[model samples]
Target: MQESSEVAGSIVSEDCLDEVIQEQIKTLKNAQTAALSAVTKRRNEIFRLMDNCDNLHLVKSEVIILCKLRDKYDESFQQYEKHLTDSSERNTVNKRHSENTASIDRFITEMNNWVKESELQLTADLDRKSLCSSSTTRTKSSRTSVRSARLKEKARLAELMAQHAMREKTKVMEEQELRLKQEREEQEFRLRKKKEQLELETKIAMSQARERVYAEADNISDIVPKDTPSPLNPNVDPFQPQPSDITVDTPQLKANVPCSSSHCRFPEPNLDMQLQSQQEMFLKTQQHMTAAMLLPSIEVPKFKGDPIEFATFMMAFDARIAPNASGDADKLYYLDQQLEGEAKDLIGGCLYMSSSEGYTSARSLLSQEYGDPYKVSMAYIKKLISWSALKHEDPHGLYTFALFLIKCRHAMTNLSHMEVLNHLPNLQAVVKKLPTYLQNKWCSLAGHLREEKGGVDFADLVEFVYRKAKAANDPTFSKFALQNNYSKP
Candidate 1:
């Protein structure tokens, strides 16, 4: 029985030991699960830290690349700015240079024009002098011819006188011869008549005596008498001359006769008539010669140089031909017809110069010289203005035209005003191209146009201002009015 109890005790102890071991095992298992959780959390934290470090490296590399690009952009921007600045400066310089060149060219051109004008003027003067000299020479030659003609007429008169005297002397001699012949014929006729009368008387006496003797004898023998042939029979009186046989001698006239000096007197009345007829002829010839001398001879002088000088010379010559009178307008008109082509154009330009001088001056000059001064001056102004506008490069032409417009402003009409307006843009361009002083001067005039008022037109105002200034003896105002009045609208 004792042994059985001990065995049971050992078995109980063994059960107890088995139970403690199970409890300890449960505790260790719980500790092991908690430590595994802590290790896993640490590993996850390490992995998260490594990922954050890789992200930072990537971000830093990206920032470095962006910084380099920004630096490159800044450099490029600076270069672009520098290039733009340089280009701008260069452009400005080129513009300046071009303007300088243009101004210099303009000045040179103006100088050349002046020189050419001077040369032309000199040449014209020479031509005018030459024409005057030629005219003088022609007059001298005409006088010489007239003197020769007079001498010839005198010689002819002397020869006619000698012929008349000789003819008169011959007529006297013939008359004397005829008178002497008539006297000799009368004396011969008287002598012949006396001889015939004596013959007839003798015959009558003989017949009577014979008849008485026969009467006594016949008483005894009448028959004897009848047989005898009577004395009156046909064959009787044969000694008497028949009428057919009778001859009368005529007296002969002598052609030659001696003349007394007194009978050969000069024929004074006939001489006077001949002299009078000759004087009439001489007077008629003298009148014709005088008319020829009085007539004007047109000789247009040649001028190769200045048109202005030529115009002046031509005007003077024309004046000499016909004085400035309304009646002489046709002469001026015909004179223009005689000019052709370039000569006419040159004359027109010279007329424009007169227009530029002043309206009053142009009026006086043209009125005296041309048939229709107003019409001619207007035409000239139009032509010049057109030429200047068409050939825009010539500043001299423009300047001259502008001057003409200013001078003749008072003469402008609606048509002229329109013409001025049409060319305004071109005129402004030309004005800008002028020198600084000119520009200021023109601008001042333009200001006047803006300030001007009243109902008076631009043309009338110009005339009034000009006259007023002149009357006031204000040279500056007069000059300004002359230069600027036409530029006003």
Candidate 2:
């Protein structure tokens, strides 16, 4: 019974030992699988981070994460390796110890080699990326330097060209000055000669008048009858009256006397007065001629197939007139009188007449009839705006439209905000195509309008818009605004 029990106990121990070896193998295999999964996961994360290496900031952050993962992987792998070695030494008494130890050693060696290769690959990739980044930065710097050099050369060339142009302009100006001086000197010489001639003629006329006066006195003395007695010499003999006693009525004698010579003219005093008046008139005429000469001769630009061509020209001409005079009703009336025929009819009917209450009736008639002036004006303005916006050309049209707006603003005191708003889009479109300064000015005006807490006053807004348009640097617009006193009282 004892022997049988011993034998049974030995078999139970053998079974328990086999079970322990199997459990150890299973645990080792699980650890190895876990470690492999962790390595794979870390490797994938590193690869993802490497793929995005173009972003330095992201790559830097990923590097830190990869380092931590690598550390964790190493720790876990070392722990697994230590556990496998210990399990192999403890199971040395078991027949499967050599196989299990060899397998664990192979796995650990392979994992270690893989870790080293992966780390070396990561380092090589980082070095290559750094080199590439340095090369790209150098290339960019070189390109920028080349572009800057080109720009500088271009600026230098432009400056040289400008200087050359300025030199040419100065030369032309000097030549013009010399020519003007020569012309002025010639005119002065001619005027001086004319003045000397006039003086000589005056002297000759005075001598001739003296001789004629003496001759007339002698004739009167000879013609007087001997029988006629002088009132002052009643006591003396009628035919022997003394020269001192002879009292002649000079005024009556001069009036009744008729000169037989055709060359006889007005008295010397009257002639002198007439000559003085003529000299004054000539001086005035000379002064006017000089002023006209001094003024710059501007060639009026030609317009073809334009309905408002003459009107535009006249408006421009009016603008060139002095602002103070241009705004005067008398001056405008004078200008109207100067016009003749079709020109008179066109400008007078279109602008001058439309400036007052008469235009309202005309507009009303036109509106009631077929051709509305307001509609025509609006259509023209719309066309100008479209042209300006699309081509970024034809500043004249834009300038004309602005001028029209200013005129309308002044003429129509009842111009409403709604009316301005209706034309606001067109105005803005034209403004966009304007020069930078004008665009800025319009923007500033718009901003100011927007900032006003209270609603914009119609009259004030109209005035502001007119003033803004008048402020443009365009000479035509400037002249128009000044002539009409668009912003002034």
Candidate 3:
């Protein structure tokens, strides 16, 4: 009982534990109490037999009642400590927890102690039964001795009565012996009848108690399994599923290369022949690798006169082909190859100029016309203003809108054009472009941010919108879970 109290104490304070477990402990602590605990106590259970030392009904009855209480206690405790952790009380040491759990631990400990003490008392029971058997054995033995002596005396009388009548006297003695045997059988039958009557009464009492248990609660049968599990090992893991074979279907590559049938190899080659073959093979493979490099891994973006596209196009051109080109002439040629429509024609005159001056002239013309930070930044604002109002605040549309805002934010980052994006009027216009529901969410978010930082920025709204958009996306989306999405305050 103390150990269970200690386990419960580790979580809950003494006061809360008292409120929850004190009531139950009160019932069990006293032998006079008529609760479940007192009913299944050691003295009245399997430890001792009935008064006659014949009926085992008390043992079976105690076992059944204990099992019922065990189930009820298990359910109550499971609900109590299901997800309750002691760590939650780290900041508040006085906080009470696991109120139901305290009661469960108390009941389990009480039952386990009952079982233990009963086993000890069983030793005394064994001695008592042995004594009962010895007494019955001695009485039966004395009766047998007396009957044997009487038979001996009768045989002596018969011998004195008849030498010629010996056969008739022997028959008469046999009849007397048979009569005595019948009388002994009648006595044993009467004892058996008495025991049977006692057994029937015990069975009736047990049946009435069982019916009362059923009448008290029908769900009791459902809650308690036939072969009840031990409470100590409640956390035992169920059988784990074994890993199964995984099969993947993929497109198989087929041969497209022309097969060679030269049949040109020699088992032993002259030095000149081997040297020539090696040189030819190495040069041919090197040429093939160089040809492979000419095919671009990333498809080049075709830029028109749109300033919005200017920053990304220039960044891509600069990263991939521009730095590798030793001469400006090569850079200009690659740049022209990546332009189209208004952008290509805008640099047409410079393309015809001499290589030395042509590249510089074309490059400056393109940057001046399409790569101005102010122009690029204005284009982003224009995009936001021109964005069509959403028909509904659906996850896909919200996600798409969030992506556009994110792109604008990323583009303006290096350009230092955040002042335009952070303008209150511009932010309001962006919020206005949202569907009714999201507009409200954005307002709430903006209010929260304004309280914290005095004002909300484009980055803040983008982050806020992106989070909700991602969270509202379907569970089939592999990237995010709702808990993970909204984890931060």
Best by TM-score: 3
Cα deviation of 423, candidate 1, in Å: 7.8
- Residue 147 lDDT, candidate 1, scale 0-100: 88
lDDT order of candidates, best first? 3, 2, 1
User: TM-scores of all models?
Assistant: 0.19, 0.26, 0.37
lDDT of 1: 0.48
Task: Evaluate all candidate structures by whole-model CA lDDT and list the values in order.
Answer: 0.48, 0.55, 0.68
RMSD value for candidate 2: 25.2
Write candidate 2's Cα lDDT for 227-280 as tens digits.
433356668655764569667775533645655444433343344455456566
Best by lDDT: 3
Candidate RMSDs in order: 47.3, 25.2, 54.0
**Candidate 3: which stretches are off by over 4 Å?**
1-296, 323-327, 477-489
Model 2 ranges with Cα > 4 A deviation? 1-268, 306-310, 314-376, 383-459, 465-489
Q: Per-residue alpha-carbon lDDT of model 1 for 235-261, expressed as tens digits?
A: 755677557766788664343442233
| Candidate 3 per-residue lDDT over residues 199-269, each given as its tens digit | 56555655565565455445544433344334456587876878869866866434443223333221222
Q: lDDT of candidate 3?
A: 0.68
Compared to the true structure, candidate 1 yields what TM-score? Answer: 0.19
